[model samples]
Target chain A: MAKIQIIVICTNLIFLAFIARLIIKAKLREEYAIVWLLITVLLALFSFWRKGLDVVSKLFGVYEPANFVFTGFIFFILIYLLHLSIVNSKLQKSITKLTQELALLKEQLKETNKSKIN
Target chain B: MATQLLIIIPCFNEEDSIVSLLNELNQMVVPNTFIITVAVINDCSNDNTSVIAEKFSVVVINLPVNLGIGGAMQTGYKYAWENNFDVAVQMDGDGQHPPAELNKLLQCWHNTQANVVIGSRFLVNQGFQSSLLRRWGISYFHWLNKFFTGIHIYDSTSGFRLFDRKAIELAVQYYPDEYPEPESIVFFAKSGLSIHETPVIMKERQGGKSSIRHFYQLYYIIKVSIAMFFSFIRK
Candidate 1:
């Protein structure tokens, strides 16, 4: 294997090991850890099979394999960002609902206390 | 059945204008209404807005953190939905939306039985016309909305609006986090909800700067246009 390919594979393996540690330590949820593990594995696979990216790029009519890799990385990042935004939006909605309910419940409790005292 | 109306005024540091606006609302009576309650969603205002709002008969929902106008308004809608309010009206707390014109919206709601009734300034060209740049921005969105949804809402950016039970229910579930007014019109129309626009005069804001400044006008236009485009494509 080429020195650069070996380096890439080693980096990917290190990242995979780090993610596994996080998963084992319960720092990252299993669902997200699975996604990270899959990405790392794919990176290691591509690094081991250096010609695989060129083959896929050629099949997809991409002239430059490096450009294809960058584009794919960017596309994945955008999808992940979009997913995070959706989750953030859902959490925002639920938080707003909870705050409203808490405010109303506080008001009700105040009214009840006042009536009881009267 | 007599309509139970909840007027939701989303205020953020409007210390100068809120008191007088609340007083104006206090005196004005909407005819043919069963119960009228004014509530203020104090969006974590740094000023004494909450104290002033509480001085009146208004119910104040003091948010622990700032949620901007859209989130604050959604809280009010959720309150209306849970409290069994037949209708909810969104009026700005900056004293721009005239309380006297509220009856016109209620009347439109009664007559058309529409899911949402919007108070439009461009319909009759009455009251405080916005700046030239702002008006141009509004016209762009107006045209974009027509092109996208085939619906003509002259003032899609107007916050003065009346929402019926169905509309309130929908908004309570989900509302755009920011710049929601224009996007909401397109959303409601696409969702098969009936929307009616009534001509009403609006005054210039009494105090505090507008969230969208002159420098941000271009950015606002681009952001809202992109947001509308996404809403159009999204299922």
Candidate 2:
């Protein structure tokens, strides 16, 4: 019982640290942080429930400290992918804006040149 | 003397300016402008740019894939080399570059008989209300050019210029794909080509937002700087 309690507190503390770091980094959006926070919390709970995780980890041949570390890596990668998606969206928007502005300018330039011709 | 100049106007999605740019080019008082071919490299524009360009007597190079500014230029340079012209001028198809002032660079080319005559907006510390970042980039590369290749080119990144056959040969033979504009100056100087500049008036790009993205702006500066440094070290 004491071992379980200690593991639970340690996992919660580590997960809480991740949440604090993400907030400070301010890269991932709030909505993304919510989903990530939920996942971390769930994983923390799962790690606290040792017997279930032990069985799952044994099944995956990650029965040692591997479960917590692997879960942490996956959670970080998910957050990173979310950040990247947002960046890609911004690039797309800028490219669209530029192309549209170019089209409009070409029209005005055409009119200017035409008037000068007469 | 119009000097039978072959002006290479590189266009991507410039359907908007193609016709009028052609009109302006036709009216220019350049002597014997024989084949003033505006090589429009259709960067796979989904628009009607190619159809519009075809209406004019301009040479159109349709790339199966978009190779960007450098690729478009190489295609045009290849066309210029194949056709056999005395001089080739690179004017922007975006309507930013004035067609009339092409004469200034051409004149510089003829007068100085330099291998490469650039239409420089930065030569006299004039032209373009550039961003602070861009200004810094220009200054850094100008210094790098002097430091690396012992060639001092003022406007290291201007796409507007005239290149004779000798300059074209080197560029066509070996030009970097990603950031070719700045790096090309280094290559031109390294090849012992007399690089000269002419003061020409330029304006804000009238249409389409510039292709340089905010995030990639630093990437561009870094990539070119590395290439310049590495190319220097290679020497």
Q: Write candidate 2's Cα lDDT for B1-235 as tens digits.
A: 4444567666677777777777887777663544465666666676787788877766555554555677667666766666576678888888767788887886787689999988888766555647878888888989989997787787888888889989888766766666687888887787789988888777777565677879888888889998887766565
lDDT of each candidate versus the true structure: 0.90, 0.73
lDDT of 1 by residue, B118-192 (tens): 999999998999998789889999999998789899999999999999999999877887889999888888888
lDDT of 2 at A56: 68
Name the lDDT value of residue A96 in candidate 1: 69
Best by TM-score: 1
Best by DockQ: 1
TM-score of each: 0.82, 0.64
Q: Candidate 2 — which residues are off by over 4 angstroms? A: A1-118, B1-3, B33-35, B125-127
Query: Could you list the CA RMSD of all candidates, in the order they appear?
Result: 3.6, 11.8
Q: Which run of 10 residues does model 2 chain B get worst, by summed lDDT? A: B30-39
Model 2, position B198, has a per-residue lDDT of 84
The RMSD (Cα, Å) of candidate 1 is: 3.6
Candidate 2, clashing residue pairs? Answer: A102-B207, A102-B208, B2-B31
